[model samples]
Target: MTTVQATFDSVDPATGEVVGTHPIAGPEEVQAAVDRARPAADWWASLGFAGRAERLGRWKAALTRRAHELADVVHAETGKPHADAMLEIILAIDHTAWAAKHARKVLGPHRRSPGLLMANHAATVEYQPLGVVGVIGPWNYPVFTPMGSIAYALAAGNAVVFKPSEYTPAVGRWLADSFAEVVPEQPVFQVVTGLGATGAALCASGVAKIAFTGSPGTGKKIMAACAETLTPVLIEAGGKDALLVDADADIDAAADAAVWGGFSNAGQTCVGVERVYVHERVYDEFVAKVVEKAREVKPGTQIGPITMPAQLDIIRRHIDDAVARGGKALTGGTVGARFVEPTVLVDVPEDAAAVREETFGPTLTVAKVRDMDEAIAKANDTTYGLGGTVFSKSRGMELARRLRSGMVAVNSVISFAGVPSLPFGGSGDSGFGRIHGPEGLREFGRPKAIARQRFRAPLVLTTFARTAKVDERVEKLIKLLHGR
Candidate 1:
């Protein structure tokens, strides 16, 4: 028997030792995988909506039953708290179930509009499935991020070829295995493990569409590559999201949300609160409350280690730059071996890298704005528009709508992520296309429009034998209906 050797080591951040090893798939292996997937995809797509939904339900049951085990794998690889891992799993399962239950309603046949000129024709539109979809997932929120694309695509009747981040290949393999157990008759979903090269190979492969979740820099590169083949893509890139606190906002509640949003999962969240804008009237009070909350939260005790050790340097540099540029740190401002101290800064300069760039760590910068309008301007200045929160007693909804983003929460943070009915995605530099709700179901399917002529037209304008008198009468009728 031939055995594949592990190409990379999976290190436990809490410790420094290797927990497990994952096989690295080369270019040839990737091509072979895609080749094998073609027929399987056809077979899976042939199973109509009901058949696919039944298989998806079985897969959901398996995942729900083994949720803890999968969460453990996530914790081992990402160094997030077990509770945080469980939350991700629960959201992933919820999205999977929603995708299966809502696919038909979202993609089923529907009557389309017939123009006044084509009143004798009947028109209809239906969503057709894409062939095979390629999903390149991220390490942070491994379960939630990938499933946003995978489950939606699968439920839309497309096979998925997943390339999980190298750091968490085990979790990806676990997901694929569970799915296989539910749909053993067809290789409907598969996993190919490796690093950047593996991901590039998947992109170059002839998949119908590619869904990539990662940094903006990497997302740009993926988009450029996909353009070569004219293949459609959906990107869920990183964010420098903000939380604006109005003058009448509850300081304690805003402070609590800031702490959780900025430090949870060690601030590895894409929608984490990296920047904050506060009204000058209550800025001092809000700062005090935030500092109090920051003091209560500490690394390795309240939060876990930085899953990616290299991120520690970026976090430290952002803090240093903020302080060097006249910003003040009211709390922790240091980096440890595997963790970053919970840090909060006030009066950070707008142009500083800490404010301009994305620092995916447990650090936040707060600024005092004159009023809500200024708060909205500063919040919209960033290139990212993923997710944001607004904390205001009266202006919550109005402020939430003013921010240019895909999802916004009123008086709360990240609540939109929990709502299964809302679409989850972003606009502007954050990327386009959706991966949740009805939009997500249609994302994996193509719109097919059908038109049939039901009866002969009274004027018979389509035929070449139409006389000038008939054309003049038709023009007069159009002008009469639309106004001269």
Candidate 2:
């Protein structure tokens, strides 16, 4: 008897519509994909900066032309509004263009100044592609987030084998297929469909590096699996991101940012505002404005359904825990089958699970802090620090500087993700390593430093045939020239 591989369906979380069926790639199949990519990686890397940029330019144009069509797929698979889906696609396109236009300057060879002792030698360093990059993408913001790594890796001249989340395989397929229409010669960019096993296979398939975006627990598992081969991995994990509203902050703007940041995508964003730290003088006003905005944005309208049903249970548990621990629900307090109403809680303790944990749902805990210092303290008191926002008229930058997070938006939320020049990632459990901007270009490549002698030095310190007289003369010269 022969064994048959398993298959899974991508269903719409809101209406339970079967969007597409994807094969569960087993280890052998996963390894096969990586094997096919090895030669393609070399071929792609052979395309120097100018050649790769031209190919990437065509791919970017393809993505830009078919962006709306792709956004429809994203909306169908992830249940986000078509407009929001387009927003993500647009950002991905911008990043793709940025990488293509700037790759040469960021990763191309550059002269390095040699030290005084090595002035006779010339030094140059350039970033080289890491061959094959395995990207295990998250379901939420599926296209935008993964494309950050995917575009940069490709622009840096590496083949990519992507494993999208099981929930949104169709979107992943759409991306790869779109790219193929532009560059059809090789499997430079391919998608492997499956669950956790397929992802693990990619990690152990000897890919040069793995870029994973998901929960920290799964990140740890990926790290452990990659340990066997010592494969490098970049983990963009969970974030309990916080929003701070100082006394001088524009309360309306803060409330708007909090509402959109926390409730958009049904609160499935890793950088969503899960907690609000407001100065005592403005805490009451902030809560009132947030409640007003929360009521205005209804699920399935301004917000969307929870893409991952399992996350609904986590949201429920967090709300239940918060309410039972002396917290009051200002607007929403209940959960539904698919959509979670925008919920706001007050009088919640800092120790409450809702505040301390990553409730990847549309929920916010509002707390009163004596001053901006206390607000900063409360915001930094978390295991994950992916993204943060500060809404203050006078002290926005000052407070933003003190936050322990990789990316922060002053007077805004999640704007850092749009700027193609800014790097994105986080410290701690939010995960290390960066994507986007120059850092992203370097992330997928290794520096190749070259040193060559311009002319033979009179001293010949590196020569094996140094005489005692030469050594004594060098020592005397060094002491006389540099001795204190």
Candidate 3:
């Protein structure tokens, strides 16, 4: 049997050995994969909502049945805890279900005002499928994150070509393969496994839209590449999200949330709480509680190894820079061979790299602010606006609305992901466009307005043969409507 050499090996990180090998597809192969999707897209779009919904139902059932197997793949590849992986899969299933169930209502035809002069014409708007969608996924939360785009696009009647994070290509393949089992008629969904080059290829391949989730720097490059073809894009980039604690907030609850939000998935989440701004009155108490809670969490016991080995150096740099700049490491600030200590640094300079940049590891920097205004200002200072959390008894909703983020949790952290009705994306350097909710469904489809003539108008404006009398009547009607 002929064999292809491995592209890259998936290491156990804790052991640093090759756990599996994945194929790295080149540009030509990537283009071929996208090209193969055209016919499938036509057929898939032809099926409309009912057909797509039925197939999605079957896919959901398959995913529910094989949830454990998929979770194992996720854990093996990303090194997250099994329970965490299960949580990610379950949330992904929820998003998939929401997309399937709501696509029709969200994308269906709706009545629109025709204006006074055009009252003789009936107008309506509906969302039409964009044919093929390209989803470039991230390794962190491999299932949950990518499914945000995959499920919505499929629900909107678009065929999808997913480029999973190179580290977790197996999980992507598993998903596509499972979908194929349900809809064997065509390649309505496909996976192209490779590195950044494959992702760039997809951006340049003329897909109607590309949904990307990664770092801000990479997101810029992806947006630029997509612009070459005028292809629209939805970018869920990195975030230096903050969790603000009010004077009357529950310090213990805030501490618990901060620890989990910061350390879970080895701190690889874009919406991970990397910074905290507490009211000065409760600063000392909040700091003590957070440190105590953070101490209870340890790398490899509560968290997992850094999935991508190179991120270790970045994490180390952030910690070292904070410490060198007179920041104090309250709990863990050390790096192991493949694992990073769950570091919580306080008294860090505001300009420290740890406070200003994305560490992408198990670390957080907390600061004290005089009031909610200062807290809001500090939280909005960063260019990222992916997600944030606010812990305030009297001002939870108010603070959440004031934060310049895509999604905000009032009393909790990461609850927006569970709602499935709220849109998820970011602003500024965090990137634009949305995923999840109705906005996500519309992102994969194009608006199509259909207008028909219901009766003969008193004044004929569309035809060139209109007489002076008709023109005068139209002018009179416009004046009567606008009172000009």
Candidate 4:
């Protein structure tokens, strides 16, 4: 009997326009993609470092030649401004180039020093690709976030099967199609579009590893699904990131960073500043500056509509909850059908959901702290520790070290994310593992250690022919060398 296929619509959140219709990519289709990746991984790996790098360069050129086209797809699906979409693409292209340029150096065999016990042996180590990687990407930053894993995985000689966020499948498809233009003979990178069940199918599809980016609750569910097969997973989950402004910080710069970090792309960024802690001495000044700057920018003009309709309800609820519990809206708190004006709240309870949970909206709660110690404490109090920003002149680095988040920016906002040399991920509830930089390249590969003997020892201890006297002498030598 012929079975029917399932499909879904990709709607433009801003206008409710049907952007496209995509096949639901059920378990069978997902598995087929993985099956294709296995052979593709072999073929791509056979190309070695030089060949793959050359092809990747072509892929990068293709993306560069038509960057605006891909960005258009991103805007249609996510409702983010075209410029913001281009920014995401630019970062992603830079990361892709970095991966292709550094893959050989990062994953190639490197000489290692043999220990004293094995002085006659030469040691070496290299990173080998894990065959096939399944990536579940996010919708907010459709191009950049998944490319962190995708580009690195391909550079490391592994094939990729990506499940783009159901909300932004067309963006993912565009990326894959452009890549196919370079490596048309093989499916080095493929996209499987669908909802959560499709992602779950990829998780259980026997891929070498699964890289997921989404909320912690969904992360937990993905983890559970992967656990059934003992499949290793890397999760870049939701974050309740904070920005701290010290007494001596440049209030103008701080306010600008806070506004951009808090409301950019409708504040759906995983590393966006959801909370702000200001020194009590300058709290009022910081609030005034932030309010003044926020009021100047209007949603739908400067910012774009919320991409997910369901998230609108959540944003409204969080704002309502903050106001109901003694919180004051400093500026821009009204929520429209598809857009939420930039909101800055003061006097919000520390325990309120708006402050404690991951609002993931264009909203921020500012709190006054007695000192930097209290600021640090309050910033690290959340269960989520992903990325954070700090605007301090004197103690930027010193204070950054105290925060529990994985990546911290001192005197700037989300700058670490753009630097190709810096690793990006999170700690605690934000999930584990990393993507980007050296850590990202290594994430897609496994280390293989090798030892080759240059010369045979006159008296080998590993053999059973060794006498007890030799064993006794070795024990004495170990005791003399190690005993304190």
Candidate 5:
């Protein structure tokens, strides 16, 4: 007798329609995937940076050519607008290309200064692949967010076993299938579908590194599980990111950014602007403009449904709690079964859940501050430090520096994520380990340092045969070079 595999449905949040069915992968299946990855990683790494890049280029080309097809999968699974899905796919494609093209320059062997004391030695450092990498992706921005890790890991010469969020497994499968179309030799990239248990299995699969994107609570759990095996992990957890408006900021631009940053993607973005601090001088004007812009954003048209069904209750609770605590809604404040209207709340207490917690919905809590000092203080008060925005002509960079997030956009919103060269991650409760750019390419690899003796040292200090005279001369040389 044969046993049937357990399966689950991926539902479209907007219409509750069954998008696809996927098998639930257990620990055994997850381990098998990692086991297969070991040899594939060796082959992929042996290809050298140039050879691997050639194949990665083909993979990216395949992704770009059929981007619309992938976008449809993203939209169907996540309930995001078709255009938004396409935008995510486009960004992912660009990052994949960037990683493949720049991997050699970023991770290839490079010379290091031998220093005065080691002048006779040649020193060098290079990054080597950590074998197999496990990527646990989030549902929101499924394509773009996970690619931050997936592309960089593959480009760095590591095989990957990706476990896409249960809600968006099809998108993950689509990506792996597309990759197979280009590089079908050895399962360089593959996907396993399931719920939390599958993710835990991946974490404990003994992969070289695990890159995860999810909630802080879940991030802690992932960390704990990975710790059991001493597996290194990269986490891009959710954030309560903020947008600050200075007294001299462009009110119109700030408002537009606030609306888009806070409401776009139904505010399911980990770096989405959930809070705003406006200077008292322009608080009313800024709120008014934000309200005007937000009103034009219609739910089910401009914004999509909350991808996760449970998020609707959280959105409702945040709104109700704010109103109960004397806050006022400037515009939209209602939550439907599947969608939530853009809600702007003012006068909410700083300690309220809406202010302190990650709402993860299309809602914004706008507060007035006396000056930029207060704005900075309030913005940095949260435990989550992922991303933020500052709108000021003169103080853009200065204020951005003060915010406690990993990446900040000045005079814009979420711009850092679009730039391929910027590293993205967070600190404190938002989690750590970057995943984009040079830092990201290195995150999936280990550094190998080499020091070769070019010739015998005249004053041999490292040998037991060194004489006192040589030691004294070395001390004098050190003092001559660094004592000042």
Candidate 6:
């Protein structure tokens, strides 16, 4: 008897055309990939920061040179506009470059003060790789989002096993193939194409760590699986993020940002602006400008099809529920066979599903608030705390600080994600553990602390030879140093 491999086809959401077919990786294959990554991780770590940086630079160059080719794959799989795919690829390249160049400075061994108690000892700290890291990516923003973990992990001297979202496996494979072109000697970055079963296999494969980006429910499942082996995990779950427009905000700019932030990627973005809270003073003017701009956004050209087919039903249900509850649609309110037009709802109750849930589609719910205080309160009321935006020239920072989210953009929309130096993640239901920047580099590694005695102190405290007189002297020293 011969074994038959099970496979699945990825289809274009807009036309329902088959994009590509990939084999489903079972637990055995997933484990095998992890096994291969172990030795590769050791060798990669042995190369030191400088050596790894040199190789990563080549990989970055490969991504940059053939960016258009990868963008084509992204566009075909996710139905996102070609330009949107390219933008994500560009940001991923930038992050790769930053991680490669700054790994040494961020993770290399550095000196530390020994403190008064251990004055004669030389202390130092450094971050070391944890061998193999597993990355489970999302279909939305697949390239840019997962690279937050993959690039940083590789830079910190660890091998990676990536399991791309089933909807966008081709994009994931493209990334791994590009990387292999530069570093073929080892499986430094490998991809396993499959569904949730494959991701579950990775979590249980005993990799040093797992970085996951998906729904909070799925994130919880991943965390539970990793907990079985005491393996650490990082999760970047979806969010019900909001955009706030203060009374003094630039109405035209805020409207532009709101429309773009809510409708881009067919509103499948994890950090997309799903809700808008505007000051009552300018609510009418802002809503008018938003309606004008939103009407200009053409489907299939400006907004793409909803990548996941199941999301269409959710989008329709939310619109129907909001309307049944007396909310009015100022622009659009219907879902098509493959696409959802930009839908803007007003007068929806705060407890409505459209307001409280993560309707990952091209929709926005705008509400009026008396002042910034109410705006902040209403914005922070959601269970998800991922990313937020404030359009206040004078109170941007003040309002940003009060929003209960991991990242906030003042006077802009989702600008923090574009900057490679900023750490990205969320709290509460949005999930925990960061990826990107110094924190991201450190997230993939474990810290090692070292201390060496340079000279013996007269009042030794670690041995059994200490006398009563020494104890009294130590007490006096502690009092002198900390009594104040």
Models 1 onward score TM values of: 0.97, 0.98, 0.97, 0.98, 0.99, 0.99
Please give the RMSD to the true structure for each candidate, in Å.
1.7, 1.3, 1.6, 1.1, 0.9, 0.8
Q: Which sequence of candidate numbers ranks them by TM-score, best first?
A: 6, 5, 4, 2, 3, 1
Maximum-lDDT candidate: 6
- In candidate 2, position 426 carries an lDDT of 97
Tens-digit per-residue lDDT, 413-480, candidate 1: 89899877789889777888988899988989999999899998888887899999999989998998
What are the clashing pairs of model 3?
332-343
Q: Which parts of model 2 have CA positions greater than 4 angstroms off?
A: 1-4, 476-484
Q: lDDT per prediction? A: 0.89, 0.92, 0.91, 0.93, 0.94, 0.95
Which clashing pairs does model 2 show?
Answer: none
Model 5 C-alpha lDDT per residue in residues 95-191, reported as the tens digit of each score: 9999999998999999999998899999999999999999999999999999999999999999999999999999999999989988989999999
* Predicted structure 3: lDDT: 0.91
Across 1-484, the per-residue lDDT of candidate 3 in tens digits comes to 9966448666666667676887787788788888999999999999989999999999999999999999988888888888899999999999999999999999999989999878898999999999889999999899999999999999999999999998888899999999999999999999998889889999988788999999888999998999899999898888999999999999888988998889888899988899999999999998888888888887786788899889989999999999999999999999988888888898899888998898899998999999999999999999888899999999999999999999998878888988889999889888999999999999998999998999998777878998999888877877887885
Report the C-alpha lDDT of model 2 over 156-216, residue by residue, as the tens digit.
9999999999999999999899888888989999999999999989998999999999999
Off by over 4 Å in 4: 1-4
Question: Please, what are the lDDT tens digits per residue for candidate 6 over residues 1-484?
Answer: 9999899999898899999999999999999999999999999999999999999999999999999999999999998999999999999999999999999899988999999999999999999999999999999998999999999999999999999999999999999998998999999899999999999999999999999999999999999999999999999888999999999999999999999999999899999999999999999999999999989998899988999998899999999999999999999887999989999999999999999999999899999999999999999998999999999989999999999999999988999999999999999889999999999999998999999999998889998988999999999999999999
Q: By summed lDDT, which 10 consecutive residues of candidate 3 come out lowest?
A: 5-14
Score residue 158 of candidate 6 by CA lDDT. Answer: 98
lDDT (Cα, tens digit) per residue for candidate 4, span 357-472: 89888999999999999999999998998999988999999999999999999999999999998999998899999999988999999999999999996557889899988888
